[model samples]
Target chain A: MVAKRTVSEVGEFGLIGRFTEGRVQPVSTLLGPGDDAAVVAAPDGRVAASTDVLVAGVHFRLDWSTPEQVGRKAAAVNLADVAAMGAVPTALLVGLGCPPDLPADVAEQVAAGLWAEASRVGAGVVGGDVVSAPALVVSVTVLGDLRGRAPVTRAGASAGEVLALAGRTGWAAAGLALLAAGRETPPGPVAAQRVPEPPYRAGPAAAEAGATAMIDISDGLLADLGHIAEASGVGLDVRSSALPVPPELAEAAAELGADAVSWLLTGGEDHALAATFPADAALPDGWRVIGRATPGAAVTVDGEPYAGPAGWTHFT
Target chain B: MVAKRTVSEVGEFGLIGRFTEGRVQPVSTLLGPGDDAAVVAAPDGRVAASTDVLVAGVHFRLDWSTPEQVGRKAAAVNLADVAAMGAVPTALLVGLGCPPDLPADVAEQVAAGLWAEASRVGAGVVGGDVVSAPALVVSVTVLGDLRGRAPVTRAGASAGEVLALAGRTGWAAAGLALLAAGRETPPGPVAAQRVPEPPYRAGPAAAEAGATAMIDISDGLLADLGHIAEASGVGLDVRSSALPVPPELAEAAAELGADAVSWLLTGGEDHALAATFPADAALPDGWRVIGRATPGAAVTVDGEPYAGPAGWTHFT
Candidate 1:
């Protein structure tokens, strides 16, 4: 194998060129990279926007995952926010900070990973900035179009509304448990921890199906649901039996002598969409009714307060 | 003075609440913070977008400048990119990563500075994320509306077009010189380096005036202009005598026994707008013609190749 070139050897502009060369932009991109700013078509009267930052060691360890995984995880988290807003993601702006001594190929893998994941949502990388720092920091800001639909915010849930969820939960947390326990777990949970593929389409579907409120589970389910409950001035009563716990998570939890229910309730970063709808509303496919919203501000599991972790807090 | 609370004490969620609580939003904000994502009005069909990252120590030193200055500078730099596209800025999404040990007030000041600078252009802070990191990293992504006008891009310049600038030059570079030389300098240049105030409205004005090509002077005059020349496939012949050299820059150069012309040519972070226009077009009030787009690929000063520094490079 040939030796790889380093970022310091090619410089910032050179690395940028490598990332942008021959890139095919999506139809929403009015003006792509190479300019001071990219022009993206926000056909709707309003544009939904969100941002997230991932730092090395704190967010992800470079040794455990590839740069590609890191890139995909960053893009997925940001896109998940747009989805949670009941919007279709259109574009992304990535701001990458890496040490100069890093291999150019590593940065390329990161950019490639960004493209690969963006293509999953049919969005494109519209603009970015590259800077030198002591460690790798990936910051992604996503833009989405609401398509004339009102945003499904956390404040819209009403008492007596049915609480529902789409996609897997607690899998990522179980994967984290495995990684922490230093045990060889199944590939499914481990991959879930490394690269989260949020149910992007479920957001728009829930909106079309008349979702009253929605939020992406970046923090644990209990922690995130608590946010919705507080914002909507309602209590979320989650049914412990309704959660779809995958076999891999259960197996991993059993091996680690941990409770899978705790992971299901408090797992964060799964990028699952939790939403509320009218009691009699017809639910869309992949959405499972979990419980109901009640008056007051609390999130309880199985008619009782959850006693496990409150959720992942950036600073504890 | 009372002892200030640290970020770790307040925790990430608490600090976020403090920064967002009771905040005033601009007219363009349809949905502000506290949701899955913020929605901003995009009256025009297209939105110009850009992202930039500023790492502590690499981009700014906390000992030399206040957190407010860093926040303002971050907002200004990102807004300048939107301005460079000849679009009206609409909203900003900030992603902040800092150590948990940082003072809570310092983070608040950073957010406040972002708000202060964003208000200058009538834009609102739509959304953001805060994460824990080893050091402070502020990443800002700005969105802009073209208002039915075509985006001014770097690839539109033509040979024989007049090259003009709408803001001051070399001030930030001069300020950096004073800081590096450990000399006591006036507040003007030092402030310029700390918080750049680019002519934001001038971007739309230049666009209305039919600017053919445009770029922000973040990477020094010669270096950034070189980008326009290379992208437009034209030579830029800058008249050295016509280049704007502020008085403070000259004084600082004299005190340091450095050539002021070098600073004027190669200074970065000034965030000045440079564009190419029809030679016969009536220039706007703040814009001054300092050069002409020529028929070759080289950027010349006074018809000769510049021999000074080629501006900043993130990596060696």
Candidate 2:
């Protein structure tokens, strides 16, 4: 029988070597892990960067989500933020804190998840720091390349522009609803919640087509669009009828007696792209027109304000 | 009297707005916060990146150090990593996790501390995320520009090269000993453990002066030098008599009946820079030679293998 090695037993440096060994790094990485710092190609003279923190109990539960799922979701969310800026992800630096008693394989699974998601977009996990802590905390910082194009910010939307969205919106929220209700959910939506697949290609495509402003819908449709509205000094009127509610979400909502539309408007962590474009400008394929930018600052659905909760908040 | 507000009361977005409202961003930032991602100028078509995670009760204690000290130390350590690569820090991304019960001022103090240290290096805190957790965790990712110079990695030391160091050694460990012994120490050494002042300038100076290899001394002199020796496939013979032991550490060692040389050899968190230069190369200012690289794998002191505790281990 094999003896199970804990993180504390292998030590910090040993664990890092274990995870980094035999891993193939993306070509964009000039230098990979094992150095004090890693060198990655920026290519465009500027690098786009963002960070996110995930706590064990606050952001995820070990019992509900596998270590692999947590790692993949963490990478996906940060990559989504980079994509929202109309940039291609080049590298990621992960900072992880785990309790000493954790099985070494669990940490490896987390690293595997990070590598899997990063490989999907041709990005590399170039460097990271691991330390012992009271609970598990994963912090990811993503670096992206703009490719000499202008970054699509949240403050560029104008009145009379058309608001649009790319990728699924309500799937993750529906999965959350199922988890909260203690009901078993289908594998598709459950995986969607655990590991989001954001439409990364749509971001650069929309930027190429001249998107006025853009944001990743991590904090729900209405709440995230509210950020663009607040930044650009414009209002958004989303048409609820135009929202593409997945059939699974609709069926789940009916079974749970919950409103699927609420999930569409206020469910968070879908990592979908929401943006605005000129009324006459042609939008890239996969982007569905959901609303229009208006002169006022209020975010409304079908011209009336959203009566339910706005979106996810870190603190209650 | 004003009621003390917790992080949850003001909400995550509200707390972020409060901290970032009037903060001045560094000039290297092409785009600052309040967006999906921030853009920092990389200049030489490449970026040097590293990350560090600090957890409460592990890396620091709130009762012993102020939030400002914690923040500054986090930034300083990561900046030291960049400097070890012979690069100048340009930007930082912070990810913070705190319990909802944490006072809002505590979080602000942490951010203030980060901004203060970053400004010293002419870098900006371009982006960050805040989330509620069971403990306070500060994860920092620093980006630096090499300005078209070749990165000084750990694999270049030659057998005939001279091993040298810059900045204070064993000061932080001395301070930790004082703290652990429940004795009062002078503010200088005490502050060293809380907030390190790494010799950032010496890195590029050594690089320009044609140093063979470099590493930040976060994990003690012998241990970090061991990394360089292993990577460069050379042995190091350090001269214990030549080590620069600060006067305060000597005094403290006398009081505790401990050997200051132990701290110098095995103490961690000083964040000094250790490097190797050609035997005949003129030493740069602020650097002192204390050893030489040899042809074998063992690290020794004065031709003898003097082994006390080698260095710190995360999970002993």
Candidate 3:
């Protein structure tokens, strides 16, 4: 823990000076932070955008997650949405809220995490705002480039299409469980909770390969699949026998006496990409076919209705 | 007040459906909400961005402001920043944090307010996140287009330049003072506080006229100009004798026994446009010559130090 630095210690202007100093904007950003607004080149003539807000205690526990981890997650989640649209991320805008008593370093670490993750997806942060609040809150909005490719949406999936996933799953959920259990140390699942490793390039790859529909699994796999089904007006059937589970997740589930299948089926926050394609489509690297789109508006596991929790639902 | 319908009643997906239905995208936005991210056109090959956050108690009091008012104010402040950049606003992404107990109609009204104001600016509310929080927090990120014009910044103001303002000044401050005083009925200043009318087109006008630099007066006129002076490393002197004082502001200042000059000179949130131009530059419409730029780095009034409060500081 660090001693808190009063916000007035570095005046609002002074804090802005610290946050913005020496940062280089991508060539696409014609104007950045110092101005009223930042100007970025949208060369493809179209831009993609999404926004998310992560609140303290609700989105992450300060006691369990470092500010840096929170920052990375904040930026990464929005970046995943950009990628989900099959777009090249170009610029980001962040709005941060914190108590005036919060340490300056915490703010800096958050910015660092945001920058690091944004850079991973080849994007730049162009502008931001810092305001006083009762609790720490980080809100991020990402703008992206479609690069002349048509956007892949959740409503485009069709009957007889193959459902594939191009990233890991259940790790964040496992990590959340570990944290809930009061584990003093970071285990594989707990570590997964800190920072998700989304497969960034797979989204564009799926789009290039003519994906019929696409979505990112921020909710549990089943819940996300249901979103595709509802949007595409079809049914989805997951083959539980073919489910992929991380070895660490399996071990952790065994120790906790929890069903690994439950986590694999319903855990979320791994930001894995899921898309439906024609039967003849070629799968991209890292993609695993876990299910198939069917004619009826229902979901099943191994062709049967496996009894378990449906998935994540907002407001419990 | 109407009966409050719990947000949980509509559910997150239901609320999204209510907000996004019937929304029209400009030719610029190829994809709108319901997709992972929206696609909008930036034909000029550049995009301008800015973000701001408003807390329930800090930025606006729910008791004094309707949810719709809060939404309009939230959008206005950010859009003003984009206008300050001499860019035409294109899209906005909103992130809202509210308690589960709040009314869904309140949220919808907020969104409607957001849409109304964005519509006024000829922009779309492209995408957003809705999450539960302890209090209401609105985060808005604005994306704008340069329209092939170069961006105007605060740094280009130099010595031997005339400083002028285009639009109302001190009204919002007087408005705030009136609101704080709690008159039985709404006063002119209070109305100004509720909704500020920014000089939206003046930025491009200044840029087109070869103005050296420009900024919007979100803070007091002196303080914001101080930014331009500090950024340009020059001095600015405001001529109080030539300043424009709206009668509404004058009456409120007189009623409150406060110095009207101080309010007009150092007050903020008027969203007025301030800029410096060459000695012989032609000022734009609704503009008044109020000062000049000099060789040193400081802000003054009528060639002397204005003996009063400096300006608005957020935390204090």
Q: Measured against the native two-chain assembly using Cα atoms, what DockQ does each of the candidate structures obtain, in the order listed? A: 0.86, 0.90, 0.72
Tens-digit lDDT track of model 3 for B55-173:
98888887777888888888888888878877778888899888888889888878888888888878888889998877889999988877777777889988999998888788878
Where is model 1 more than 4 Å wrong at Cα?
Answer: A1-3
Query: Which whole-number lDDT from 0 to 100 does residue B167 have in model 2?
Result: 91
Q: Model 2 Cα displacement at A221 (Å)?
A: 0.4
Residue B155 lDDT, candidate 2, scale 0-100: 94
How much is B125 displaced in model 1, in angstroms? Answer: 1.3
Q: Which stretches of candidate 3 lie over 4 Å from their true place?
A: A184-186, B1-3, B184-186
Query: For candidate 1, what is the TM-score?
Result: 0.98
* Pairs that collide, model 3: A40-B47, A47-B40, A175-A189, A175-A190, A220-A266, B28-B41, B175-B189
- lDDT at residue A204 of model 3 (Cα atoms): 85
Q: What would the per-residue lDDT of candidate 1 be over residues B221-304, giving only the tens digit for each residue?
A: 999999999999999988988975678787888888887788888888989999999989999878999999999999999889
lDDT of 1 by residue, A1-316 (tens): 9777888888998999989888888999988988899999999778999999988898887777799999999999999999999999999999999888889989988898898899999999999999987788999999999999999999899999999999878888888778877765787888888888799999999999999999999888899999899999999999977986678877997899988888888889899999999999999988999999998578998778988787899888
Q: Interface RMSD of the predictions, in order shown?
A: 0.9, 0.7, 1.5
TM-score of each: 0.98, 0.98, 0.95
lDDT of 2: 0.91
